[model samples]
Target: MNAILIYLLKVIAIQAVFYLIYTLIFHKSGRHSINRFYLIFTLAIGFLIPFMSIPKFQSYEPYLEVDKPIWYELSDLAEFSNTEAELIPVERINQSDFTTELIVAGISLISLLFLMKLIYSHFELIRLKRQSKEISKNGHRIYCSQIESPFSYFKSIFIPKSLLDSTSFDTIMEHELVHVKKLHSIDRVLMEVILSIFWFNPLLYLFRNRLIETHEFQADAEVIALQQDPIAYQEILFQQINAQKVISSANYFKLNTIKTRIKMMNKNQKLSKWHYLFILPLMVFLIFSFSSREGEEFVAPLKNDVSDVFDYVVNLSDSYTPSIFPLKDAEGVKLTASFGKRIHPILQVERMHEGIDLKTYKGNPVLATADGIVVEAGIINEISWGKIIRISHNGIFETVYAHLSDIEVKSGDKVKRGDIIGKAGTTGESTGPHLHYEVKELNKGFLNPVDFINDFDFKRYTSIEKKDIIKLGKPNQKLKVVIDPGHGGRDQGIVSSNLSESEIALMVANQVFENFKSSDEVEITLTRDKDELLSLKDRVSKSEGADLFISLHMELHEDEEEEMMTAIYNYQSEHSAASQYFGELLSKEFEEINRKFKVGYTEGNYVLKNAMSPAVLYNIGYFSNSESERYLNSEKGMKEIAQELSDAIMASKY
Candidate 1:
């Protein structure tokens, strides 16, 4: 279910409960003021209750003293828990699918139409006021027009020209004056606007109808009280019952609810104030059912000496500051998008881009811009940022890294500047591989990340020259190798008219797996054997305890002549030397088979950087080249490529 849809449902449910209460208990009450207030108050509170949050108690085992229970108030606990005391503003996302988005668009369209209608209604009133002859009476401007009925909007009362000379003219003025003096037109307009937005909810229409009925009842009661003749006022209302009236943003002297108005007017007994006491429990029920509750960890109980705990409480230091660029490699930094308002590339709308995009290769390391505590490091509700990390620094500044393919740190973890937190990739609502970086201050909202970043110091954090090789097994143990076929299931990476990158990668990866499956010296594991959308994290996890991890992929190049077998290794990894060695051997094997081959290094590439062993991502061929595509599709080409790659992997071990 969509988050927006869920929120709408919650609001609708709350409104329904309020409606039920009104219809059952308060609708028939003679107290019109109380009924009117209940309807209007509930109408507003129904929409607000979902956003409301309350605090809840949670037991903390760390501070629990079983023998002597010590009660610590929330004020006292704030000094002990620094993060809990401070408020961090996190962006709330309403995750919606295509169908949900379409539904919301439709709803907005309908609401816009209703708003237009309301505007037109007011325009009609303004036009009528201009055309009519204004006659001043009782310090009020009365617009006498050639109409069948009378109505009031603001201080302007519109009456039929025939009634201005008739005996019932004064009586008609009295009813409409009540609407003007009491500002019933404002209520009418307010309800109309509410109805326009929530027209889909039938109960809202009912609420509007009920409000109109109460307005008529109140006006009738006032008129009867002034005239001191209930019978004559009833007769006047009955006369207007059959008259056709213009339904603009005006309270009319019409009788849509004539029977109810008469009954309410005749009733002398008022409902006891004690009957309203039921609302207290109802409000409590709504708060508990709909309002959000955040767990507050209880650090103390009821009894014991807790003065020592307060004395030792130390505040969190806010001295750490960022010094280096988030990306370690200065050469790889390519600014694709900058912060601030711009036409969104994907949505094609003028929206705020709160972060700066650093375009880098897939599987590049995303460093913490500053020494900070990891506030949030995981996948959120929306896939727009597939994996994100938010670090709070100096208790005032915060940095956010979004659209990552892999996350290395977890929430609450401490990190230093330039530390690898994740790998950048084309995850979420992205066009290609890049990192969306943001810088935020405590009071001031999102600031440009470029403002805080200094020149990248590549020498300070140079790539590891050598990596310790993990012991495979005993002297005669088989080498465990994990082969990952990139982009499966719904994720058809680098798609062409005839074939997808996933298909080509899988076909070649399967052939490599087949070659190693029968070998006594090697044991092979496929991250995904069939069509399935396996996450980058899942692919890296499967590489655990394996001697080597090889991710097979196919890519498209703009140039048709760019057809070559390429091997990419994570240069920053501790196993960089072994990965580079394997890539070199693989390049040589491809050369022996008379295939165009090249070996390169990348700071990005999720699987290569995060895999438990020496890893490499090998691009077999460019799908963009017609001849290369044909060769990749052919059975002979797959077998030959797989054989050479397997030969190199076996040779590289020596």
Candidate 2:
């Protein structure tokens, strides 16, 4: 669900850029069909591109962890322990409605209502068509009704009685005929669905307005091109300026103000094809703008800086970058303590302080440090903190806020940095009511929260160098492979006395990842390398660019001696022959590598079945069988399995 919202947002952003390009560059310069094609292409690409990942090849080099880095506390004399001290949940007297779940649920519910309205509109149009008297006029189907207004729905045209006898009927018919033959209703339905799905994006609404205008311009220009009396058509359209509005698909002649239609009709100039080429640069800009964060070698700008900040703070009303104080509408917040060694206030023992504590009101609202996805949220009895929220800015950077009076986000919730994540209070190993803030860069050093805030840089970065861009700008010559490791986090698959599905799958996937990472022949990716539970939506969204996909898993059964492995594929896949061929190759590899194991073919696993690429689900030996379980967990078993799979992939002719 979180992935769906993120994808929608990415698409909305891309669509906004494309819409701007069309309005400022191509809309006025080219002929109707040319501009129409551009608009459609922009819409189509915007909707699809978020699913397509830009290639990123980071050198998977090793790094050593510093025992004591810049941000390391002086109080770490005590060793870390898995068992945390019993902690109390923080108490907040009054809480506000600033919560992530409510906001997401509200948006989703509203979109559903919008969908219902769209369905109603289509059905209402159909009901009207069924009740109306039908007659054939000039090789078109016309439905005569008592409606005060006239409009076309799909291939059927509905006309009111007042217009049937009027002299303007032929001109209106000419307009409606163009709409029907050109299949404008299909465009209307598509636009309606797009709007329904992305109703939150104001840019889409603006784009819709432009699209409606373009449709009218095309139809009006066609009617006038016949050398019919243009004056008569203008008079007919404006005469119904106060036309009764009705629930229908768009592009009505009388519904909107007649000024735009009349103005377009009055124009008399031919545009040059040269203007359309301007789109090339804008497309490049859009790609670079988004690719910065996802590509390797690109240092992320401070999230919500400059234009991103403009979008949230100035325009959309949110905050990020942890630039501001956590307390909202507060003045002169003083730092009570620094992040370092401190005497445990209550315990009377020395300890390293990993986080900075700030002096504030007991129930003051606590904001997020940056724009990120909530990785962890809730009260933890196993930790010193009562309620903690951890958010990951990218995959590499994370911020943790501990000892909160209340938590407003859950795992997988995307949040802006300044949004009130909770109320600050004393909870779990706290001396007093305050907020504990920490910043950690995975595999790097943790930085002082204060220093990180003050020294935050907003430089934009990208990995697509000139030559790389030129290569990517052309058609692909490299193979793209995505590997999905089945089950993770709380959704850990098939657990038994000794073997864990998620663990074994990840171990094998990691080896496969290492095998492919060393080679430049294929661009390899994993749906997950760690135990972060991803929804089916999230998995499918990231699997868009794969030429071949493999999902790893281990399933247990009732029989203890059942040790044979099975490779599953999408029986309904478009490339079924290719999948079958690869499945056979995998069976052959397993048989040749280890005679102790046998391979079989199966069909219809969800992850495999839904993959767009030729994908398979490779289930390792069942943990249900004790002998197989011991063998699967052995280091030798893991290496042999990984080698065989890698070899099979390399040996594939496809």
Candidate 3:
């Protein structure tokens, strides 16, 4: 809604600037046709320029980075919690709130009223056409009616019955004939429609009046082109000085601006064609200033966050390095698959095999191939390699052990070579129980695990090292989540007497975090633990390896007499399915607690747009509403809200 308001303001500014330029320099420049087109064209550019996105040019260079090694239907991983139930009813709010929504609605209503008036006048013209007497004069159709003055609507020229027999009838017919031949009614209708939509813009009214004057100028010029005496035309206009006004939708002949119109007719200074060339620079300025600028495109280096371990793996394969076999005394323990391009057994598609699959029975001890510190040891709720462990060895290389049943070592644990880090089993995307082992140098991609394995005969293709192994059992896999409390420090959002939006947002986020910080199945990380303002880009960057991104925010509705409902917005894109599914689950939980909730999709939110995981921006309530502010600040109310949201998030793991 704020984005919509900003766009409208931008359009108004552009139109206002153009209208000012038109009035100061081009109003009486004596080029009616060209000036007419300028007005309409500027109006169109006002609406279009804001949507343009000009990409900046820069030299392109490829960065060394690991690519995704697996692909799956991300939406299919979560079970949607929606059920066949009665529709939920939303609570009502005061309609008199001076909120952004109310302002937009008011503008729409006024525009609609203006549009209806225009439509009714058009229909009246149709009725007048049907009721008036028609006659042919000098290859033109004329309609005689009880109107106050002569006017032209499209192809029909209507004149007052009293003027049909007047001495200046021939001259009046000539003027109306010019309007019909030049399609002046089309310009009037176009301006009228623009006025109907933007009735609040004073500049539009100015443009409309100027355009009508331009139509009269064109018609008067055309009349003069037929060798009509200027003094005689002036006499005709003076005779209609007291004529009653006609409907705005029609081009009526009147003497309201007779003196100005007459001066424009006699004006001698013609607008140079070069004068229009100045508009090119103005157009370029608008394009550069209003349009979105796209930065140079480049690949970002992979972070050390293990959240994306499913996509890229680090492998090591130095023949000079002596590494453990990682499998101890297992029957049929043999090399089943080698690294490189091969058909994935479970996916049935040919893709790069980043790791070598070892044939080993379930519950077989899996040891660390080298002395290293455990970096990642967890399970992801996905279809790719599951129950994985990544070990960073001496800051030079890393090793990955996937498809394990039990992880014995937690992250940050230092272990020697031949220590039992896990047990072999098929946990993710495997046809049978086997160990998928990988190794890689730091900053490099995955290498063939077979190259780093010692005590393995390449010709026999079978290996086992049943010695010097330490065993421990402590399995762990927590759903990592990043909770972003919007606004902080200097960026205090929506200040009130009780609390600001930033304070309240952080309060609610902390409540949610406190509920799950001790849970084994869930892990929560707050983007900001204190009242420190974090940039939207920084917030998204900090949530790099998160499984879910939840941004907490509050709205303001000044003059609101009732509480505003909560809203959950999911990211809108190809990756939106998972976010939408999660939003549905969260909205239901909010509803269960008697909180009226609305679930929608948004594309303009920066945090949501950049999130690499299932993300939602949760608008808690309006801060301007006194009751909502109190509820948000209350400890008990915050606790209940946190409990419901946390429950929904915990349920999404399956």
Per-model TM-score versus the true fold: 0.48, 0.43, 0.43
Q: Candidate 1, which ten residues in sequence have the lowest lDDT sum?
A: 75-84
Residue 644's C-alpha lDDT in candidate 3?
83
TM-score, cand. 3? 0.43
Candidate 1: stretches off by over 4 Å: 57-102, 297-654
lDDT of each: 0.71, 0.65, 0.69
Best by TM-score: 1
Clashing residue pairs in candidate 3 are 314-440, 315-439, 315-440, 316-439, 316-440, 488-533
CA RMSD per model (angstroms)? 20.4, 28.6, 26.9
Instruction: Give residue 14's lDDT in candidate 3 (0 to 100).
Output: 86
Candidate 1 lDDT (Cα, whole model)? 0.71
User: How large an RMSD does model 3 have?
Assistant: 26.9
Per-residue accuracy of model 1 over 1-654 as CA lDDT, tens digit each = 223455568788999999999889988787777788888989888876754545345432221111211211011100010010111112224323478558768988999999999999889988988899998987888998887889888888999898888777888898888888778888889989988977888888888888888888778878888989998888878888887767756788884788988888888887887798888899889978886432231112213676433321221122234545677554556554556654333221234667777777888888888766676777762445678888766344678888898999987676777789999887765546778888877447788776666443212111122113423333577878889998899998877667787887888888888898788988878898888899889999998888889999886654577677767677568887677667767777888878876555555556777988888888788777888988888889888888998887787555
- Model 3 scores a C-alpha lDDT of 0.69
**Candidate 3, residue 617: how far the Cα is off, in Å:** 33
Off by over 4 Å in 2: 1-13, 47-52, 65-98, 297-654
